[model samples]
Target: MNFFQFFVWGSWLISLGGYMGNQLGFSGLQIGSVYSTMGIASVFMPGLLGIVADRWVNAERVFALAHFIAAGALIAAAGMTDFASFYTYMLVHSLFYMPTLALSNSVCYNVLTRRNFDVVKTFPPIRVWGTVGFIVAMWAVDLLGWTKSANQLYLAAGAGLFLGCYAFTVPPSPPYLDETRKKSLMSSLGLDAFVLFRKKNIALFFVFSLLLGAALQITNAFGGPFLDDFKTKYPDSFGVKHPNLLLSISQISETLFILLIPFFLTRFGIRNVILFSIVAWVLRFALFGLGNPDDRLYLLILSMIIYGMAFDFFNISGSLYVEKMAEPTIRSSAQGLFMIMTNGFGAIIGSYGSGWVVDHFTDSGGVRDWPNIWFTFAGYALALAVLFLLVFRDRRIEDIKR
Candidate 1:
């Protein structure tokens, strides 16, 4: 169920741009709403809902209720024709929606800890299936011809509803907090992670995390649409007919690549793995800029292939690095801080920036100026790579391994 949440996102996340830009004639900023909505909601909803789960409610119940609420909002969104109304609706829905990412993780942690599972040994393997779920959902959406159509929400709505109900079936996870403790709402909700921002190195990492995050969403918000644009540039292209599934190849790559991480992190260390991700991002964008939806598609396909390294290398290794760096007492809080930077602020910056850039550079017809857009994004990533290499001080995984 947790895995499929990402699948719901992957189904339309990349393809929505094509629908908005090519099919519906919407503006780029309008297209950006998809990314921005997730970011905005991550800012508050996860914390508030998490607090409720911590003190008053069963975690599974909270999960089910959130999905149920999101399902109704998504179904209502399915009927929206205007962008503003649709945007507002999705935003509201996202408030209920984005927190589930953490809630699901929390639920899993509770279960695993209760069962005395070794999370370091067992969890990563299980979590890899979530990537599988994401890929499957993407393939399904693409194969079904549902990209950008209102019908895509039906897919997500069904998933949300099922997950909501199925959550109740999971072993109950009641709030663990003591009711008599004099806890402030911030502490209750786990917002105490904010204190990490006062430190210099951590703050720098988070700042760059937002910048890298900008690059991350660029492909997500644009890949399907960019590929689909090939149809217009050269008519009768495969992308026009098949954008969703082809973009799904990235998700497939994500699954295959995550398996390699343990070995890579052990051998190359966090800095090198992150370097691979940065370099991969540059390649990922540049390949799309050069490749076509037509015969030169090998390049396009290769770009999709590299997405695994570009996304997972940085994201997963970064997560592991946080685990290695933090004191045991504050380890969970450190993870929360990492998420706030990457998912919350980073996602917001990336979404709005990508939207503004795409919106401003493209003409009224929604045709993207591909090379310039991609190259500019690559440049931003290059800058982060350089800054991180210089400033963050490298520490080998072997040195950190317990």
Candidate 2:
């Protein structure tokens, strides 16, 4: 369940921008707009479908249905030649696909809890396999020479279809259908988590999460195309020849960095750990701005390494922070709110905003000033870091316990 779940996404997520920009003649805005579909779907679909899984059907079934529909959408997207058709299909794909991310976890949690397993101790190992699946899918797509082709979408579709069927084989996760319990749509959707905004510090933390999330989206949307573009300057470069493989280093780095998060959180506290992430984001973009396929290839590799820190620190640490701060009853809802801010609103901002920045640096003949574009991103991240430092306050985990 974990492996094939991410396999479907990894097949296309990193490479789709390159495919759109290079092969389909999509402009930066178009590329960003396409990437934003994930954000658009994430804003509401997870909660909406979660309600379905909670009230009407088993989570595994909803997970399966979502994958089946997403697979069809990916196949449809693969056949589209125009932006409108492509975006429409991809949006359909996103609407179904994004929900499965949460549904997969729900299914896992339900099964694990029923089996009397410690989710906190056991789930990470299971989750790591998903990362392995992602890395494998990335390498498979790149090695198959499908990085800039529609074949990546087909590959994703194939994985999705397989996972959709495989979902039914899992233990059943039925809805909590008690006669005494009634939930309004808003409550079921976790909208009550919005009340957390009354606390200024928590509110500021969420705001910074949104800002840093934009940096993340920028990297995901453009990192591959940026490396692939090096073909013009250094056609023999390893990065140009296999951009997806080189970018996979970031995921490898992610697995390693995740091991250090416990120490970072214990040693520095949540606020400082997240601060490190914002600073890492600064370095991540600045290095990309300065590095190339030639002598500075190490910089690119370093950027990829730093990505682990940039990504894991903010997401994992912020989630821990949310867990610490929220009341037990609202904890799950608070987590959902955190995702809405980061993956939903933040994704929309980053995708569309970075598209404009990319277009700004591109000339009429379609030559993009890659260095300047990266530098601009770095500047944005730097500003976010500085602002986050000034505005957000932290309570140490020990203090929170008291």
Candidate 3:
């Protein structure tokens, strides 16, 4: 289930920029606008759906229905020639698909707790397979020469359709509502999870989540186009020809780093683990600024390797942190809030902001000042890391366990 869930995303998430720019001739701003659909949907859909799962419907059914609809949206998106039409389909797709992210985690947590499995210990290994699935989908697209074609959307659609069907086979996760009890509107809508913000530590953590989330989309939005630009500059380069395969190294590293989450969280606690991620983002962007495919290929590979830590340390561990801290009744809502902060508000900022930066550095001839653009991004990460270190307070894992 985790496998196909991410497989659908991997098919196009990284490579979509190159496809839109190279084939469809989308401007940088237009592409960013399209990607921001994920953010717009994420801001409300996850929380709203979390409420539905918590009070009204089964989570697995919601997951299945969302994917089934998303499959049709992807197929329709593939046939779109105009940006307006494509954006509309993708917007529809994002509305249904973004909610499923929180829903899937909710379903998994429900089943695991029911089976008496420790989530911190067991979920990472299972979730590692999602990265494996992402890698496989990336390789399939690369090997099949679909990176800059609409066929990638077809691949995603097929996977979505399959997962939609498979979702019904998962363990049942019924609503947690009590019929005898009368609930306030906020509680009924799952907005009660917002109360966590009243706590200083939780509030600070979410603020940093928003900051770090900005870094997440920068790479996903531009990495492929960055590598593919080499084809125009140095047509003989391996990086230019195999950009998808090259980018797959990040997913490969993600799989390894995911397995280390249990140890990192237990030993270093949430504060240090997240700090490591912030530091990694600093290196991730700086390396991109300094390296290229020819003589500096090693730096690029190292950058990709560090992506595992940059991504998994914060996102996966943060999800586990939410699972540990929130009450059982509101667990789904808390996870949705996490998604709202990271993928919702943060993604919107990153998408539009990065597009403006790229456009600013672009010349009249359409050549982008890639190194300077990357350096600007690196500076943003470095400043955020410093701010996080100073502002966020640490709480020990022992305290969390108690």
Model 2, 216: alpha-carbon shift in Å? 1.7
Query: Which structure is stronger by lDDT: 1 or 3?
Result: 3
- Model 1, residue 201: what's the lDDT? 52
Clash list (residue pairs), candidate 3: none
Candidate 2, residues 88-132, lDDT tens digits: the string is 999999999987876776677678767987554455557667778
TM-score against truth, every candidate: 0.89, 0.91, 0.98
Estimate the TM-score for candidate 2: 0.91
lDDT by residue (325-389, candidate 1, tens digit) is 55433344555456556777778888889888877778876567988888778787777788778
Q: Name model 2 segments beyond 4 Å from true.
A: 112-120, 178-190, 198-201, 319-335, 398-402
- How high is the CA lDDT of each candidate model? 0.73, 0.82, 0.88
Once model 2 is optimally superposed onto the true structure by TM-score, how far is the C-alpha of residue 108 displaced, in angstroms? 3.3
lDDT for position 56 in model 1: 70
Which scores higher on lDDT, 2 or 3? 3
Residue-by-residue lDDT tens digits, candidate 3, 1-402: 999999999999999988988889998888888888898888999988887787778989989999999999999999998999999999999999988888889999999999999888989998888898899999999999999999999999999999999999999998876653236766854576898888777888889988888888888988988988777667877778888898899999998999998888888888999999999999999999988887888999999999999999999988888878777777788889999999999999988888899899989988888899899999999999899888886766763453
Native-to-model Cα distance after best TM-score fit, residue 330 in candidate 3, in Å: 1.2
